[model samples]
Target: MEKARRAMFFLLLLIADFSVAQDTAGEADEFHVGVILDLGSLVGKVARTSVLLAAQDFYTVHRNYSTKLVLHVVDSAGSDVQAASAAIELLESYKVQAIIGPQKSSEAVFISNIGNVTQVPIISFTATSPSLTYNSMPYFVRATLDDSTQVKSIAALVQACGWREVVAVYEDTDYGRGILPYLTDALQEIDVRVPYRSAIPSSATNETIMQELGVLIAMQTRVFIVHMSSIMASLIFTKAKEVGMMNKGFAWITTNGVANIIDSLNPSVIEAMEGVLGVRCHVPRSQELDNLSIRWNRMYQQDNPYESPFNKLSIVGLWGYDTIWAIAHAAEKVGISSARDKQPWPTKSSTCLESMVISTNGPELLSVIVQNKFRGLSGEFDLTDRQQLKVSVFQIINVVERGWREIGFWTVNGLLRKLKRDYSKKTGQASMLDLNPVIWPGESTEIPMGWEIPRVGKKLRVGVCSSEFTEFIKTYKDPITNATTASGLSIDIFEEAVKRLHRPLSYEYLEFDTADAPISGSYNDFVYQVYLQKYEIAVADITIRSNRSLYVDFTAPYTESGVGMIVPVKENVNTDMWLFLKPLSTEMWFGSIVCFLYTGVVVWLLEHLIGNEHVHVPFSLKQLAITIFSIFEES
Candidate 1:
């Protein structure tokens, strides 16, 4: 009977242990994470696929992890209000520990504020505005580079290509406008000028884009640095091509925002962007990346059946995939737990925002995420600085037929260098020769001049003047037609300058000469004519004077001017033996000696006659001569 009692107790203990084991096995931690994106856009679609795939792949590899990230995605639908609403819903309803995306920089602004209030970490792989700083939003982490990081590379490219001036064509949103200041400052550092900033609204119509392009084409500046979204960029380039602005003289450079997604742009857009140079983040090719691309292409096609089959993964997608891994690693390391059961923080019922509860695991999770370091598909995924990705290298690509070609690389240290070569940190201006041969716009091999001669308005009125010095300028009249004509050095130089413009310049030289046939009015009056808007330009033996500069601008003086005197070179030299005597005539010499003798006599007489004993002298010719010589010396 005692043995039966012992067996029954042992069975009861075994049952208790089994119950505990089953409860533990069934209770896997679900760490809720929110994802907000513009599902209607191409970038949004690609990022979504990459994020989902990354989560699946990471879990498949690390099945033993106690914490599982449960993603709750919400479509922002490309609206900032919608994105904000989505963030609030995720925080209030789902009680997410973290949030990813809210794609655009403008959209990230308000949503990031929400993250700060809730103490929930918000990580973004796409929003790259420099204004979204870590200091302002402590809970927000940028998994990709700030747009400002690549501005230096763009400036380097402009400098290397010898473009002195560029027009910044950008969308008038935070994402587009944020980089302008940095780009302008960088270009200024290199002595390059930002002549104009063309800010196109993101919602601008095709006609509006074309009108802006027309204004750009009419201006003298030919180089355009486009900083805008891929959609706007596509329309802009297409309109530019239609307007004949993609000719040989024009240069177009796109920032990484558009460049990174070049593969996903349609063939028509790619064709329109031919000969365009672009700066993009360089992701080193690897076997893992290749496999990701293959899988991504297949899965993307399956998910987006109606979309074009040619769509491929972009750099943003890589960043999104890497971001998932980063978050997952941080989650497992910090061991995040469900925060729903925690007590709600004090509130005043001042809207749903006030009633939200703060996550208990957010601060620790954020710390781990910012400190996480690992090799990701995009590059070194180190966010230890808690600001943005460290962008050391950027690829310089040239758009060609069907695809783009890698021409060179721009490194934070090396500036610019050709592919397949190791380069040291360099100082001074980078040269275009470091890159491979570039096929410029209109399929021309020649580098663009970055400017054009003004073609609008009436032909330039060039006033020519005649001078007495025919070598400088000569004006005359044809006896048969009585038409005025100009010739000589000034005419030749002016014509040559016009010829070198590479474009046709319609100009007629109006001869300004006096009726007496010597020359025109004073140069001051001729220059004043230009200032009065009578003549567009005046070419003659005109001197550049400070007084004239007040009214009219002057080209650099082609001919040096100043007062000069030329004396004949003397050949005969005076080698007379008595050259010293040539300074005075014989009569003059005798006169001087006589005067000295008279003066000596007067002095001697005064001494002797006055009975002064201080004067001592012998009554001899030698004494007399000495006295005269003394007088001469004194004189």
Candidate 2:
């Protein structure tokens, strides 16, 4: 009887062993996620790929869960109709317990509406539309920055760059549509504004959208703040080039939506992206982000899941790893994985979000992370008093050669060059060059209420670069000293102008004997000739180009002199009227007539269009057009 019982037990054991193995293999073959996607059609593909990889790699290593995550991808594909279809599939067909995403808010609303009815919690990775959280839509949670935090962070971003104008181009979906008011309000505090804005629809093709980008090109807005996701942005850029609207001077900026696939950065795209400025909660990918990358890279490299030709791939890959770490913070502490043997996992569910930090007695497990600051590759994901993510510190990045460089270098010669009292040093070698003393937060200096040239001798030789000076010299010599004062005037007049500084003034004269000489060309030749150790102070009404300013010391010019386009008196018969008019005299009278008419027309147009401020700068299309036309005429 004992032998018979043993035989029966062995037979039952054998049957169970095969069944368990078959189930394991089946689980390994598939993983699932509940995803909702709409207007972010193209980005949905990439994001879904990333999430799928995360699920797959995590399962491959540890087999603790009863079932492996088989990402049940549901695509709204940027359509309301399709969004509803995808949502029904995930809820009914997949029976997924926890959902990962509905990428855009337009489609996300449908998921939110069904949340309480279905009792499934939705964890959104990138749905930033404003309407998502309104009216206490239960069962909704976010994994990415919302439009408010995004715009506020952007406000900090613009403040960081000291930029005043940002051009925002957005699609008319909840994702883009919901952001403008908050963006405007946030920027208003920082004194920054969306000067030129365009609203595009998510359905617009590349060609349709690129036409709008042409206007950005014409506006020449320096900072381009794009509220678009990667898909539409990639389209706008491609079309911008196709329509001949791309230029090197533009500064392109975008939200974190474009931060994911940074590896798309390559010579072809990056070269044109020199001034491309974008924002990402993702820690700007660097060699620092790579330590985590090596692990995941070994996991999925076999599949070539990434199609990004840009090195930005390496960055996003590392940041994605950071995402895993962030999840580990929650899951390993509060979800199915938190080991109770350790300390508390903070609030077991979302209710404890207020305490920002999650602590556990499983120090070894938590210690595997926790030590290196709260920074996840996406950025420092610190919590606020209100259970919100605070990443006020933003990293502004520029696309470089197959890589990315932080937008402003360790140097400020680029961003601060425009301030009058403050300036940039050309060599970037770090020497103070501001006419205004550099100030620290606690210190103050008396700005030389202004600078003055102390009175000095008019006998000094000044360096000069105008042929007009030479022309005057040829016709008449100072019968006293045979020195030719050019433009039929005394260099002493220039000297006298400097003496008004209420300080000792010195006068010097320099002559440029030719035309066609660049200020750089002339200075190099002149400096090469003079030894400045002696009475070598030189002065001229030399137009300062940054390069030339470096080699010599120049006093501020009392008058700016440039070669005026000389046209022979013709056509409207002004020559007869000008026979008695000498240069300055004629310029005086004709200038008045021209100036009055110009001012009158400008004021008239301002009143005609933008309604009332007659003396205001041109802000309307018609006024701007007239101003531009007049500038062309004047030029």
Candidate 3:
């Protein structure tokens, strides 16, 4: 009886195994997709996890779908050449219908070319250089906002803070340099000037970065706009803090590239970045997003245990998550297959890249991806122009403590106190005050002036005139100290003007007199001293002559110096025919005579029309004259 029972159990197990195999064979078709990323980098690690999670969650929600995306990830290891190589390998070996990333813009350039040739869709969620556009590469699609799209918001912030000029500090790479032209043009539209551009190579040493920063410190501009990756930005801020550039009277603004991933920075890096203002792509919060963030943290921690525990998910990760959903949806619509039909190459070549087959369903898939619209984890995801997703809003953030705080939000219209509010015409345009109060560098609440008097370790040279007329400019010397003191109207006026400046002005007076020379130079030579750069400015009782105006600018005369004419007045009136005309000017006399004639003509016409007695006069001239005399006498 025991042997028979054991045989029946073995038979049941065999039957179950056969049924499981049959069900797996009849499951949904697997659609192969490739993902290329820098697995060693922070963004790479976060994005890879998000992409995996998105794929798993998508299939679980839509199990009835006909197709499933099977992702094949490759580690480009942060190299452009490697990215391109990985793309070729995926296209030839795996025959992937779509490729997700080549993290950096510099890497995307080469990989995108590969996709164009293969007729496969290349979707990048983090490569956001404005130089790469849809019009040029139709097979490439950007799931992220272009770096140029945030320039207007930067310009608006500059304008609101009343900064006249700014210096742009960027990495000397394609991704860093791509947004400069657009940034310069946007600032110019608001009447702001970009005085200088400071480019630092990605491979530059700490000493090299310090040398470059030292040059910026000697300039007059105190405002700086930084555009670079998070790693490079961390080094910049650390150096800036060391050099005292992150103190009071200095302003810094960061582009979205750095701001989006600020949450993932190390605690030490965050401390160095305190009191910095940033603009990031706004990701609307939802229940689904909240749940994803929880799962993402768990999965990321499990994968990367050595990374900082404080590191949190950022918008870049969210973009990576949404990007997969978009591709998966498009793949299903196009009825993609792992074994897609490939067109024969015209001629076989030596290189694998040249000999790769073109995907027949690539163009159809590209069209579907661009036209796909849905509310994603990172807000509304729509790639309308096939180049980039439309970005209408950006969140303004301020780095503080171990994290950052939301100050306000920027929209297409302008800055807003709240993201969603009643926008009347009068209240549409918000000023800097609309944003929450900020604690600037040095932990001060005062807004920076954005400009400073150049600190060149020397006082300004102000040349004063030593004239015979002590009332205008007088010089007194102290016998004990051998110090020369300037007094009088011009000296007092010039000193008062200096006091009214936004910042303190330090200057030393040098008398332009014969104390050092045999003979005193004329006023022309004194003003010419300024033109020769011997003196930064000249203060004296200077005349506003046209010749003197050519060399140096002169302030408007505070005290009058020109000659005034005085003539005798004749009060006695001579009795003559012109004496009556003296009361009214020549034009007024003519005007009064014309008015009297017009009044007389109108009265005469009225009497004739009404058949009054004034019309019975046979002589027309006599009647007109009588009417004129009567009207004038009545007036």
Candidate 4:
């Protein structure tokens, strides 16, 4: 009886051991993913909800996978330090396979650096700065389109409308500055000039924004390309309208940062943005996206009951959703045993210090993630070799009274399509004319010329050379009035060119040298006055020579070219007694009389030989002589 009891106890112990082993294996299949976000911001809220929903949906459809995603959420509190702390915690404590969020580019830089050392994949959906390039951070994956990608489209729009110059207005941040170089290059490629860049501090006050706008308003550029956060954009437009910059002839263009979130703006903000044009990422519509949008809206409304109805989900949210699913798909492909390996913590003396935990599975997981491609809510979810989401289409939206309206779409090939009907049938080159009619600033349909004379500023100071030689450039002063006037071929050409401008240009001509004397310096010195900012332009017989052009811009040459010597010649004497006889030398005068007699005799002989009735009547010697005399007289 004792042996039987011992065997039964051993059998029950074996069964319990097997059950514990199965439970351990099941736990190992669950992969941990960390989410670091600025939950205090509206974008963060939407992203957070989208990620959660994505994880739920991914697991439901992918139940057969050997690995499951277990998300760990942390709030960065909109602080870079907090984001770093959260990343460290998620990396060291939870040992997550991958991390997402820290929406801003500045925040992403900090976390991505940590991710590089830790060998964990850091995915960002909203950090669109070009500075966050994958070459710098191999483990970093940008699930959103880089800001630089949209610069070409913006440049195409500017070119199509024939805007000569553009002024970029951006926030003074990494996100804002990163796109400037690309935007400048793209604009230059299409023969557009970026005259000035207005950078507003992220924390700038309303007064500061207005001051910047005032400076822009006082300049010649009327076309403004705004590349900043939506909040800053709203303030800029608001202050612009307050200062009357929203009037006719002014143009405003925005990138996706502000354009994609137009629906979330307040009515007052929309009103301020009236007549503004913008570019937004284009996501193809599908049944799955439609259902997802409806679900996201309901969930957002439930999350924030005090806020107005959530009508649309931003591209960032869609990216968030897609990022979660991508992580899950990648994790599943990597398998449980390989993904759940415990990473090694760095030694005290290691280069990475306390932040040194190396993930054994990170490289493999990243490789899988980079290769993962699928159709998601935002559109096709293909990633470039750098792991950036491939975006080839963008919509140009115009701000109207009813809100933003789609005017056209910009493709990667640099074509603009007006509507779905046009896009489906589009062939050949795209043009600005293909876009829906735009209501320009001041509620006019006339296309803006993209420049205007400053309404409030000093008149342009034109430098004129006071010449001792009055033929080329002359300056005169009225003795009693002391009013200076300048007139010359150069001045006439300058005035004609100015008159050809679509608007009046206010200018005041200031003599570079005193009117009492000729210019003291060479022509180059006069032209250099423009470069020295002493004058806005120098108008004279300013020769467009190679040396002069090195210092200042020159208009097309208006005067005849080439050089000729003007030396004095001795006057001829016409009143001399022998002047008439001087026409012939003594031998030449005698020779000329003999030759005339010979010619008259030859003519009379030819008339007698070849002529008919007239010659017959003149056959008499006296008549022939008379005819010869008449012929000589006629000659």
Per-residue lDDT of 560-605 in model 2, one digit per residue for the tens? Answer: 4665887786568555765775656767999877976787577566
Candidate 4 regions with alpha-carbon error over 4 angstroms: 1-29, 64-66, 338-340, 349-356, 418-430, 463-497, 511-533, 537-635
Deviation in angstroms for 448 in model 4? Answer: 1.3
Q: Which is superior by TM-score, 1 or 3?
A: 3
Q: State the lDDT of candidate 3 residue by residue for 447-474, as single tens digits.
A: 8988887676567889887776779888
Q: What is the C-alpha RMSD of each candidate to the true structure, in Å?
A: 8.7, 28.1, 6.6, 9.9
Q: What local distance difference test score does each model get?
A: 0.85, 0.52, 0.85, 0.83
Q: Which pairs clash in model 3?
A: none
Candidate 3's displacement at residue 408, Å, is: 1.3
Q: Rank the candidates by lDDT, best first.
A: 3, 1, 4, 2
Give TM per candidate: 0.81, 0.50, 0.83, 0.76
Ranking of all predicted structures according to TM-score, beginning with the best and ending with the worst? 3, 1, 4, 2
Worst 10 residues of 1 by lDDT: 512-521
User: Model 2: runs farther than 4 Å from truth?
Assistant: 1-33, 37-42, 57-62, 65-70, 156-164, 205-207, 217-222, 241-249, 265-267, 282-388, 407-635
Question: What is the Å distance of residue 342 in model 4 from its true position?
Answer: 1.3
Q: Can you list the residue pairs that collide in candidate 1?
A: none
Predicted candidate 1 versus true structure: per-residue lDDT over 536-624, tens digit per residue: 88988887788989998888877867769999987897898999998899999999889866898887776678775544554778666
